[model samples]
Target: MIGSILGDIAGSVYEFHNIKTKEFPFLTPQKGYTDDSILTLATADWLLHGGDCATYYFRYATRYPCPLGGFGGRFREWLRQGQQTGQLRPYGSCGNGSAMRVGPVGWAFRTEEETLKAARISAACTHNHPEGIKGAQATALCIFLARDGKSKEDIKNTVEAKFDYDLNFTCDGIRDTYQWDATCQGTVPQAIRAFLDGTDFEDCIRTAISLGGDSDTLACITGSIAEAFYGIPPALHAQAMHYLPTHFQQIVAEFEEKYGPKIH
Candidate 1:
């Protein structure tokens, strides 16, 4: 989860001012965490309560409305509707929002089936579109596989076969032409590619940001997988934790305590 938060904070600044290279600073004075981390912690909170994710997701967004990590237009509207009317309906979006909050599902479940099922249930709250659901499931599966000690090649092949995403494009190849697309189909594979190609956790984030699409979402998804494959450094983890509010940090700690290897 810190991995996902760090990636969100790292890429939030670059979401618009894309640098297109992996040579940027490793961030100083971390930007406030965005919808990504907020929703992720929300998902963890939902898991702690053993209920549907959408309830807590909207709850957290309304409670912690940070403008720094901007929400998508549709998602903003969804939150507004829920807050005003207290009635919820799926927005029929295939956005990467589903994938951004899915890291906890990967960590909390033990089996591939459990991970995929939980991912689908969580995603159905908002990203019920098939591509949206696929993105969340694929990401959770990747994290699960990596934590389960599957080889990168094995992970890559399995994800490709299961999700049918074109994993052939390299970040360097896509960096020049990638546009700001939020759809899961547009975002997830590239994020996964960054993780697949990276040499380490930091490299995975740099690769995702360098792709220059939806920077925070791309890096957030990549960072979760990177954390599973290459555990976050303690200092780096502490730094990201420092950027979050105390309550959010406590949720992360509690989630890990209940469902983590704690220190891989």
Candidate 2:
């Protein structure tokens, strides 16, 4: 969960710039958390409270309508509508929104089947599209495998076989390939590669942001994998927590209370 938040905050500034190199500044003091952190915290809160996901989603989103960093317009609209109507209807969003905020699902479940089920449930609360749900599930699965101490090669092979995503794109080969796409098809696979290439948690995040396109989502994807593999370093983990607001800290505490110390 701290991995996801750090990824979001670190990559926040570069979400639009799309730099395609591994040689960019990281951990600047100016960086801050975004909607990714807010929603992730909300998801954790829901799970901790033992409440319905949709109910907590609407509740938190309504109470904190304008997060420190804004949400996508459609999601904001959904929150408004759900608040007014008290109905949590599904919307079709294939954006990285699902992938960016799905870290807690990986921690809540002990088995792969349970992890996938929780991931689907968490993603379906807002992003009902199949790809959206799949992206979330795939990320959660990667984190689960990483947390379970799978080798990078084994993790890559397993994810490639089960998820059917194109993992052919290599970051080393794409030093000059620049594109501005945030779709799951465009980002998730490469993000996985970045994790595979990383030596540790910070390396994974730096590698993802260096790839440049949709940096935050890529970082989120890589962060989840890195956390699973290396766990969060104590110093970086402490620093990541500071980027979050007080409300989000409460949510993290609640998550730890329910889900057992985040395991890392």
Candidate 3:
């Protein structure tokens, strides 16, 4: 979804040079999309066309092999190994990458069961760890619930009860001490809390980035859910399109036309 890509681009610059404050510009033009955006597109493409999830991930990743932050170390090695072996399998990773790229699944499926199943399938390609699958399912289900007109408290309770992620903390509560964390357990809960704490679509992203840990991935997850809830502002959506490649934009447009949540 465009929301996910927008967050990736917006937070790309701050991933390494983290800014703890939320006063920064909402969108950054200097840095483009990253592995988060690329894999998200891969997920969308897989859902649109119908194919092996791993193949799409490999194809998109290889096509844009070097993104802003580059692929995570293990994913980079997975690419290397896949290139040589022509085969891909689960790596048992619990990284936040699984949750970051699961936006489309949330929209494409109608039921909670379907959404969770698709999320699991998408994540099992590489992030087959229990936490990895749980993260993706939690994120996708949030989007599903948001678009279904569920209240924030309902969404929070469902995620906490089902996924066992404690969403009781605020972003400010963790900001001062939160350091860089790339795992699903650390990142997904905070991203959800950011969405719960947000005032709107952009606010959710800023809050996620302001948490100052795995900025792009955090914001990417939050943005996906926020877009489902608040809907992206027309100007923000159009501005974000400029940062995506032609092919990526095309997929976003097509997917949105078919399955996008109604804008608020």
Candidate 4:
């Protein structure tokens, strides 16, 4: 979870800048988390307290709303409506929203099946589209594999075979051809590849942010994978924790205590 938060914070400023190299400032004082971190913390909070999905999303979203440069218009409106009515019906959002916020599901479950189940539940709370749901599931599964010390080839093969996504894009290619894409299909695979090419956790995030498309979400996805592989460094983890509100910190700590450290 801290990995995801750190990624969001580190990538926040670069969302529109679209840099294509990994040689940029990271974890600057000006950086802060976006809706990706908020929703991930919310999901972890819900899982910890046995809170229902709708209640978790409603409470957190109402508390945070959309920060200055956060979610799309429809999603912001959906959060408002869900808070007002205390109901969260499927809105069929195919945005990378589901993928960006699913790190906790990967960590909370012990096995691949459990990971997939948790991912489905987490995605269904907001993103009901099949592609959206599959993106979350694929990301969770990748995290699980990374946690288990699976090789990059294994993770790629499993995810590519299971999900209907084309994993042909290389990091070099992403660096060559860049655009600001926020959709699940457009961003998730590139983020995963960033992690695969990374030398360490921070490198993974740097790689993702450098890919230059939906920077925050790409970093979120890469961070989740990095957490499973190398774990969040203690200094970076502490720094990331400071970005959250007190309530969110408490919730994330509770989940961490219950599930053990985010990375072994």
Residue range 132-163, candidate 3, lDDT tens digits: 99999999999999989999999999999999
Mark the 10 consecutive residues where model 3 has the least summed lDDT. 255-264
Local error of candidate 1 at 12, Å? 1.0
lDDT per residue, candidate 4, 175-258, as tens digits? 878787777887888888898888999999999998888888899889988888888778888888887778878877887788
Rank the candidate models, highest lDDT first: 3, 1, 4, 2
> Could you estimate the TM-score for every candidate?
0.97, 0.92, 0.98, 0.95
lDDT of 4: 0.83
Clashing residue pairs found in predicted model 3: none
- Output the better candidate (2/4) by lDDT: 4
- Alpha-carbon local distance difference test for all models: 0.88, 0.78, 0.92, 0.83
**Of candidates 4 and 2, the better by TM-score:** 4
What TM-score does structure 3 among the candidates reach?
0.98
Candidate 2 whole-model C-alpha lDDT, 0 to 1: 0.78
Which is superior by lDDT, 3 or 4? 3
Our model 2 lands, by Cα RMSD against the true structure, at: 2.0
